[model samples]
Target chain A: MKRLWGPASLLAILLVVALMGSLALGEVRLAPSEVLSVLMGRGSDLARTVVLDFRLPRALVGIAVGASLAASGVLMQSFFRNPLASPGLLGVSTGGALGAVAALALGWTANSIFALPLASISGAFLATFAVMALAKREASAEHLLLAGVALNALFGAATSFLLNLTAGRFEVSGQIIFWMLGGLENRTWSHVWMALPGTVLGCMMLLPLGRSMNLLSLGEQGAQSLGVNVRRLQWEIIILSTVLTALATAVGGVIGFVGLVVPHILRLAIGPDHRRLLPLSMIGGAAFVLVCDLITRFLPGELRLGVVTALIGGPFFLWMLRRPS
Target chain B: MIRTERINLGTRLRDVSLHLLKGSLTAVVGPNGAGKSTLLQVLAGLLKAEGAIAWMGDDLNSISFPERGRRLAWVGQDLHADFAFSVRDVVAQGRHAFGDDDEFIDSAMKALDIENLADRSVTRLSGGERRRVFLARALATNAPIHLWDEPTANLDVRHGLDVLQLATKLRNEGRAVLISLHDLRAALCFDQVLVLDRGHLAAAGNPDDVLTPELIHRVFGVKARMGQEMILELP
Candidate 1:
């Protein structure tokens, strides 16, 4: 427990810096002093509107989304006992993407702001249930992963079909493509509210299961012999991780590697004890997305948030694979 | 003290009944498909069989998982430690059922002579060392009943002897120690021997009586002679 303090402190510091950077560095480019003044309720109306109404909600959403995805990743990796497992391993992201794209293609986004996220979450839940149903007989981690893979392919194909149908309508096709690429642009307090409560509640529930998850690393029968309720733990992990992934994808629109990369890096830095790894992954994940989102702001010509993360995380993951453990 | 009556598991194990006593070291010996592992797993409460497994006259299923865990410490065959958890971390997991016990973890590691490797990752350890780490993990449980499936499989000769000595020590402490063995010679040191042939209890009693040359040949399908100190197989 004592060993966790240093890395936890470092990640906390990085999260704060990233949050500040996200608030200060944007299209309007407020100075640190001005950002602080606006935060302190002493700035001009324009600065106040930009900082308080716009940047704060966007930054908060990034933190919540990042933390949610990373924590979800930790759960998936530990539950499956496979480091390669991520939030998308269960098809939640693709399912959510399909729902959001279908909504946009069918003109549901114009109905209400909540329509996109609600549809996305419903789609994610359906995909997860489908995977569960397909793998219900076996219910092993390997079987669930295989089921997830099959569902992911099906969902991806369906998303493409929607894209094809909307090809003649440039506006609809463009919106679909933009949502798929993923960005935190024009995010509001509603997005923050949509993500924060569930992420906080889900992570809180997952934190105490760390020791049981450690026992789970010993294999199914090994863990069972150690008094872990393997079946119950499996259900808890599936529900919690799926909810987190759906919430993040609903708001962030398929932000990819924060889930995979954050947990992987934190596991390397701090040992594989989920007690430390889960919380650190939360902080690390939020910081990673915030930093990545900041980079999107600096880059020329409309680089998407998901594109930047994949660009960075893909190469880093390849390098990690090349390096021997 | 543990007792089983007419235990059966899908074709793997059938009608195997056995009794174990405190302060005794018992060895379960059988061929590859002889259900030795299935018996151990059933006894450990990791598998449910058709018949009754009672601990001190209480039905095994009646005991809660945590209570059962505190009573039985199981070391499975070919258990994999794929993650880079430190040896100490893995050993500490033995105390998980009873909550944290650094003293038990330390003593368990020391008993297995793995104190120096406590900080090393279990994933990086050799087969023998990894086996010791898992054995230490079971030892850390401080449970009265220890169920080990092929505990000495990957160990060197000295380590194998050490494990036998540790089992004897545990038995001396008035705990029941049951191990499944592929090494017939090691079975000689046990107080009682159970010879399982095709999920049946072919023979059970004092090792000297149960492991007779004729019984060995009948159960194991091997012609053997009991030499001065070892059993020799004949073609």
Candidate 2:
């Protein structure tokens, strides 16, 4: 228990700071005390509305989405035994994008709030099943990775085709492109509610599987010799990771790098013990996205959340690749 | 005791009928690609095999994989270090079904003289050290039966001897230990030997009886003799 304190506490502190940053530092800057007063129901209407109605939901959504993506990233990397693996790489996020874009183009999102997420969830499951089918045909990790790449390209092409179909309608095309860019801007309590259940469920499902994931790092035959049902575990992990990634994509669009970068950073900071790494990556991921969102909020020209993450994460990834392991 | 009859697995292994008894160490010897690894994998239940396998009069198929895991531990020919995990963590995985037992890990590490490497990342370990780490992991299971495929493939003479000695220790403790080896001299130390040729069980008996020069020459395409020490020479 004591051994967990150093990294866990550090991550906890960072998350709190990022959350506060998300709440206070925005278009209308409020002091920490002003945000606190708003929370206590004592602030003026403008402060209350700005902090409670706008910033709060966006920050909450950012945290939830970030944590979900990061947690799923940990599972993906462990499952594939590839550090480069993340939920986005497997076409799960692309599937969600396609689903949500399809929903928008069909004008189903206007009729009901649940339609987009439901469609996104189905899309995610479809992508995961497609990847699983490829994996079943060939049990090697490299083959599965190649299959994921193919699925990603296929999903990307399908999504672009949907966007092309909506080109005649300026409003729908703009909405699809905005969502694809990915952001916390204009996110509301509905978005938070939409992402909350899947995030919580994905975490619950993934946490207990940490031990099995650790064992899996030894490779399939080694894991089996230790009594792990490799096939079953892979299926469960795929489903849960898809849920997490799909839900986040449904609400926040295709936020990149949160999953890949957060877990990778945490693994380096604290050793790769999934028992600790999984939960810590959740916290670190929430903070990372929140901080990145906060940065985007201050940057001129209303930068997309995905652009901000790629701008920072792309270089870091390259540097990591160049470094001797 | 483990008994198999006409257990054919894949195109590589066919008609492999053998028995492994408790309180004995069995050495599996074969030329390259002669289905040695496949035989061990079949016995470990990692491969689907046709025909009958019984363990202590109970059908091997009836036992659950986890239950089979509790009874048998296997060390493969390669332990890939694609990720960075501590030596202790690697050994701890062997205790998955049995739960965490620090004493078991400690004793296994001690057996392989890798106690000081408990916290060191496995990726940094030398080939010989990594081989010992894998051996320690298999030993840490404390299973009643052990199947090891070339556990000493990259080890020095001293460490290779250490592996055989550990097998000897496990046999003395009334555990069934099956190991594959390229070293005929090391295989000669085991209580029983099973030799393979082109996926067929060419010989099985006491090492002295089954590992004759003529049999070695026929199976391995090499001239061999067991005098003061076993020797293999090009034909």
Candidate 3:
């Protein structure tokens, strides 16, 4: 759709410039022309490797990871109807991490690239399922949020216990740590391959239901008058959010705060119609994750992407939480 | 276009039998818990109506969801929220069923006099402003049937008159508007009134003949008298 032409477009244009900077400002510092050549398939070996093999994959991961989290964030926020709701708030990220750890623990995924995301997806699905089962009988936004908090705690406990049990295994432990902290250190095209399908699928499922979501904001009884099949839509949304979250978590482990911050900022800018809101969130999310990845990869050190996001988002989150309603 | 016979909507609606015609401003008036809202929901294809709501003489449930949404527009209660949206965005929700028709949205915004507020956030609007925005959204749906759950609740007296006058205009345009109102004066101004008392239909007819002193006393448990010009004076 050729519709978005306001704050969202400016952000998108800025992202394009930032993406160019991201490809150029790394260790080797390739010129824009060199980066273009590498993208267009005719560059020096180091430029090609730096831009295509290393920086390109990293940048792509940033966009995908950011977008997936942001869209998932928007969906979950709308799903729970709480401004504070996010993938992290609901503990879906932790659950997916545990699933990735489980896949590692099984020792069957050492050679398989799909194992991590698949496990994360399953874990995310299970965690959300547990939340749903606990509060299904009296399901309100508050109850659902409480259920997410409780399940998040339980999943955290389980993941910690698994970490404690597998303390000596470096490969498994390292994978778990990197996954837990979140990173795009050596992400390949295959990682991009895995994340793209589900994110696209999730977008396909959720955007068409945007009007139904608007009806939902009017509250439950209000929705029924608009012919909204509330239960069915709720289920689809929960599952779609889980799937998208899992895909991101599986590819890059549990990145936090993109879901929390991006949609909210965009909502403040564009308001709450999912049609406009969701698209803006996608652009903003991609920008946020790309910026974070730029910081993590080019800023020199073992500071994990997850840790960087937490450090940035933590104060912002608390500031948001405490800044008076 | 709503026909219900022996459709049990639990406690609110008990073995109700009613047929509501289209293209007139029909007021559903009652006290609290009179099942007026429930009946409106049933007619709008919102509730899990067991019996049929024949839309143009076809089974309502048998049709698809999008079709139903395009056919019926509902203005619900308690629509206020903490989340801020522009008056334009909120009103654009009505045209959602119309499949992104910009022409429809442009005129709908103009009709509701919310064109100036298009860029302004809805959270900052006054009570009457908010109510008018919601009404504008419902109108933008361009559906033939409109169900409003106290559409004039928060409006000032002047705005309330505007709402009623707008309803009259919509009705005259051959659109069906069934609104539930606690205000008897507003109900009297409507083309027709359906009196509900304790989840049962007390009476149904023109505002004058149907809203008799006896029916008023029976429904509201209040002594009432009528004078010339069909003015109702109540105690």
Q: TM-score winner among the candidates?
A: 1
| Top-DockQ structure, candidate number | 1
TM-score: model 2 vs. ground truth: 0.95
Q: Write candidate 3's Cα lDDT for A35-153 as tens digits.
A: 89988989899998888777777778778788888988887777776767887666678888888888877775877777777888889878877777888854877888888788788
lDDT by residue for model 3 (B14-37), tens:
666766677688999987889988
Give the candidate order by descending TM-score: 1, 2, 3
Could you tell me how far off, in angstroms, the CA of residue B124 lies in candidate 2 after the best superposition?
A: 0.6
Model 2 lDDT per residue over A121-191, tens place: 77887887888788784367787788789999998999899889998899999988988889988888998
Chain B alone, candidate 2, TM-score of: 0.93
lDDT of 1 by residue, A1-325 (tens): 7668999899899999999999988878888899899888798888899888999999999998999999999898888887768899989999999999999999999989999999999999999999989998447888999999999999999999999999889999998899998889899999999999999999899999998999886687888888888888888999999999999999989888888899888777788998899889999999999999999998999799999999998898788789776
Q: Identify the superior model by lDDT, candidate 2 or candidate 3.
A: 2
TM-score of 1: 0.96
Candidate 3 regions exceeding 4 Å error are: A1-9, A21-37, A40-52, A89-91, A105-113, A131-143, A167-175, A200-236, A270-273, A298-301, A321-325, B102-116, B189-192, B202-235
In order, what DockQ does each candidate have? 0.67, 0.66, 0.32
Q: Candidate 3: which docking quality band?
A: acceptable
Best of the two (1, 2) by TM-score: 1
- Candidate 1, DockQ to 2 decimals? 0.67
